[model samples]
Structure formats: C-alpha cells, structure tokens
Target: MAAIHMRMLGYLVTLAMHGGNMLVMNSLLQGPVMEDPNIRTFSAMYKRFFTVWTMFLQLFVASLGLTTDYYTLKYRNKKEPQWLGVMRSVKNRIFAAVLWPTVFLVSSLFWSLYHYDRSLIYPLFADKILSSTANHILHTAVIPLVVWEVIFQPRSVPKKHGVNVTMLTVYMFAYLFLMYYTYIEQGIWMYPIFGLAYNKHICFPLIISAIGVMLFIYYHMQWFLTRIVWGSQVKIKK
Candidate 1:
C-alpha cells in the first residue's frame, strides 16, 4: 500500500518536473504517421470541441464525485449502515443501473472524437517543455485524477471497485487492439511515451504499472469504506 501510494506520488513529481505539461505538440512531422486522419490537418470542427469537452467533462465528473462524497458523509449516520447487504435493491439500482451506460457513452465519445474527420486541429503538445507542459498537466494527470476521485470515493467503494475494474480492464485491452490498428494505419504510436523505442515495447510496462497502481488504490479504498465508513451488514435473503 505504501509502495503504491509512493509510486503515484512519484508520477506526480515526475510530471511536475516536466514543467507539468501533458499535451505533446502534434507536429506534422513527415514519417509513416501522417496518414492518420486524427492528425492529418489543422482544420477546425467537432474534433476540437470534443477534445475540450472530454477534458472538461472528465474534470466535472471528478469534482462531482468529491462534492457528492463530502455532502453524503456530512449528513450520513456513521452508526447506521450506509448500504444493506448484497441483496438490497436500492444500492444496486442506484449505483449499477446507470454506471455502465454512462461510462460507455463517455468513452465512446472520446474514441469517436479522436477519429473524427477534422481531428488534427492542434498538436497534443507544443515543442517547448515549459509551454506545452501545462496542457499536458491538465490533459493527462489532472483529468485522470478527477476520474480517480470519482471512482475511489468512500461511499461509492463497492460500485467504484466493480465499475473501475471492469471498465479499466476492458479499456486497456480494447486500446491494445486499437493501438495495433493505429500503428498499421498511421505507422506511428498513439501516445508519445510508446514512441520511445520507435515502437510500443517500452510503453507496455508503463501501462502495466498504471494498472497495478489503480488496483492497489482500489483495494485500499475498498478497505477504508468497508471497515470504517460502511461497516459490515447482514445479508437479507431474496
């Protein structure tokens, strides 16, 4: 647990050291990658709007999660069960019912916008580190942290574990396959980090490490909720 937290902290520090830019400049560098529709030109369209939308939307969800957590716990009776046993309909209905659809819609929006016709409006990051780092900071680290807050809130622990585990697993695999398609189509990589070896071999480790970190956090969060906030409850037979 300590190691996992340390690793996350290390990532934050490294990102800060990079002057905190998360956006990589999207130079139309001549190579095999120019073929990608996402980066083919700087035309203005829904693509740009979608990028902004995704970043802000992620931020909003994260904020909402934190605010929700604060208010719920503020009024909640710590002595009483926040949730019933697995058999309870309300908890499952309230949490599970909208979770999948909401996630799928949001993720789909990103995938679609990423590939939309006028997609290549701006370079992900500008050439200068100090200049583009702020964008990168906002785009990568900040946005994910927001999503993390939403996924790891104490009252939402069970739903958070189930949803994040399922969604993140699916997303990682789907992105793996999509990356191959991207490489084939553009002859380049999706993330700059993957372009390290002129291929993605070095990048796989980063993805794996991120997943491990997420799982560790998930477990710790679940523990905090179960043992402290939610407490144990009796299962009612259906």
Candidate 2:
C-alpha cells in the first residue's frame, strides 16, 4: 500500500504539471484559439488535453486510491489484528482490481498510437498544445509505473466480471454524454474519433462497444500481467 500510495502521489504531481502546461498553452499562448465563436464554450476553463478523457479518468482513480490508502493506513490500529483482517475485503480491492486496467491500457495505447503516427491520431496542431514531456508523462511513463503496481501489489479481483463490466460501461456512458454536451455547447470535440463526421449514426455506439470489449479482454489480461511479473510472490483470488 505504501508503494502504491507513493506511485500515485508522484503521478499526481506529474499529471498536474502536464495539465497546467496544456492550460497555459491554450489560454495564454493561443489566446484567440479559445475565443473563437465556434468553440467558445467555457473558453477560460478549456483544457488543451481534454480530448483524451481517459487520462483524466486515470488521474481521478489514482487520486482516489491515494486518498483511500492514506486514510486507511492513518486510521489503521495495528494493536488489533481483527481490524487489520478487513484489508482483504472486496471493497478494498476496487481501486487496484477494477480501475487499474483503465490506466494501464490507456497508457499503453496512447503511447503506441502516438509513436505509430502522431498525425493520424493526434494532428499537427495538437503539438502546439501538448509537449513531449507531458505526452510521455501521461502516455509512456504511466505504463511502467502502473504495471509495476500490478506486478507487486497483491489484489483480489471482483468475483463477478459482469459487475465490473457493468460499472465501467455506465461510466463510459456518462463520459460520452459529457463529450457530446461539450461538442454541442462549444462546437469542439475532445477526441477526433468522437467527431460527428466520423459517423453520426454508429460512431458513438461503436466507441462504447469497443470499450466494453476492451474491458472484457483486459479484465483477464491484468491477472496474467500480474502473474508474470510477480511469479509466485502474489496470488489473486476471485
């Protein structure tokens, strides 16, 4: 738990700085960019890196894990073994077991995609808003840190895959709603793939369906990564 907490704290600082850099570029450097009538919704608060919402979600879950582990450790009474036994409960595994996949997968995919063709996934204009350091922080460095956590941390995955998938699906649904709302209000889409020109009829559903499939696949893949990195050091029980 200490290792996880430390990793989360480091990530918190890295991601926060990355975000701050993006905001400064968007507001101060590219002043007229936000004032454009077509995309003027919440111009002052617009984050240049907002299109990639998964990064934000990863930051959120990392913060949540740090907070949970901090208070649990702070409040732990080692004098009583009975109180310590509760650490293995399902509730305690939610952060590592359920949400870790999102961070690892997003980190892997974004870095790979950026390397393969920055222009295809992220256009030339995006370079003005995001720097190499910020890109590496969110996309490259995160992969190893999270993978290390998975390898080292002993976690109990949810007993029911259906439950985990359902929760993620609901989250994706809400995220999509926010994505569309932002587009309607400000005329800018966070992700290029979410652009209405992609296919108004099927793109949204396709994105959600793809996420559902990815979650299903990674739900098992995480345990495999854990097993390989840890060998017999740790075991995950459903």
Candidate 3:
C-alpha cells in the first residue's frame, strides 16, 4: 500500500497535466478548437496533421494508468480477479517494459526536429499558438513524469514481451501508411518535413527505415529496462 501510494503521486501528477491539455483542447468556451488560422496547424487534421505521436501516447498512458490503477485498487488484497485480463488488454507488460520508455525517445526526436528546424516539424508563425502552459505540459512535462513512472513502477515483463516490439513497429508502419493515404485522399502533407509536396520514391523508404530504427531502439531499451530493474530478462510463458 505504501509503495503504491508513492507511485500514485507520480501518476496523479501525470494525469492532471495530461488531462489539463485535454481540457484545454476541448474547453468549449475557452477550448483550443475554435477556428483560428494561427493555430490551424495545431488543432486540425486527425491523420493528415502534424506529428500526433505525443498526443496519442500521452493519452494512452494517462488513460491506461488511470484504468489499471483503478482496477489495482478495486481488486487489491482480493482473490485472483480480472486484473490480468485488464492488463492483457493494454498488453501492459510491453507498455511498462518498452513503450513507456520509448516516450523519452519520441519526445527527444520530436523536439530535436522542432529545434533543428521549426518549420520542418512545426511551423514558425504558429510558434506562440498554444499557451505556454499547454505547450510545456504537453511537450516538456512528459519527461519528468515518465522518468518517475520508470523509476517507481517498474512492472513485470512477460516472457514473450518481444510481441511489443513487433506491435509498435506495426503501429509505426500503419501511421506511415495512413499519412500517405490521407495525402492521397485530401491532397496535403501533414508535417513540414514532407514539404508542400513529396516524392514518394525517396521519402517512403526513408520513413519506413526510420520506423525500423525506432523499433530497434525499443528492443535495446527493453533489454536495458529489463536488466536494470529486474536485474535480468524475465519473460512469462504464453
């Protein structure tokens, strides 16, 4: 109970910050959704928009953490319940063991690209579009919060956690395909890196290769997390 209490603080903070962004995004009266040309890049386009990985994964951990912790408390000290099944729904072994760690990588890659060339990832005129609170909480805050989760709540890894690496790769490829398909459907490129128009022959392979590199990075991250926390790789038999 004490251990969970300590960790819950980390999760609560993360939830508040993430949910704050959600609130801002959907504030209705003061919401980010009002049609303003200044923030059009920030708010518009579901799949054909700019990098959405941060928003997707941020919401994922917040929702998953909340739900999982809810169940953990509900079923605490009780007989075997549906918690394991709940975990399986999120494929949480890989989540705690791999995907969560990748948040750092993704964050790094995003901001790095943004910093290197703002318009390459995010445009320049829209620099001050999001309030600093919104920008910092959504973009910068994940680092400390995720690191806190990693240090405090190093959950168990399944014996077959390799599936996570594969799933993540599939997700990346799926997103890539979606981006291309969306361009065909709507005739626009989401990120500035793709420029106003792109040559698929050159960019597609590069994008595919980048996804592969990200997956490979996750494999090593799995090894590093497994070794550091559990002191060895522990895989549960499927």
What TM-score goes with each of the models?
Answer: 0.37, 0.66, 0.76
lDDT against the true structure, each candidate: 0.40, 0.57, 0.60
- Best prediction by lDDT: 3
lDDT of 1 by residue, 104-163 (tens): 333433344445721322345322222434444433444344333333333333434575
- What does the lDDT read for residue 106 in candidate 1? 37
| Winner on lDDT (2 vs 3) | 3
Ranking by TM-score: 3, 2, 1
lDDT for model 2 comes to: 0.57
TM-score of predicted model 2? 0.66
Name the runs in model 2 displaced over 4 angstroms: 1-52, 67-98, 108-120, 200-204, 229-238
Q: Residue 214 of candidate 2: its Cα lDDT?
A: 74
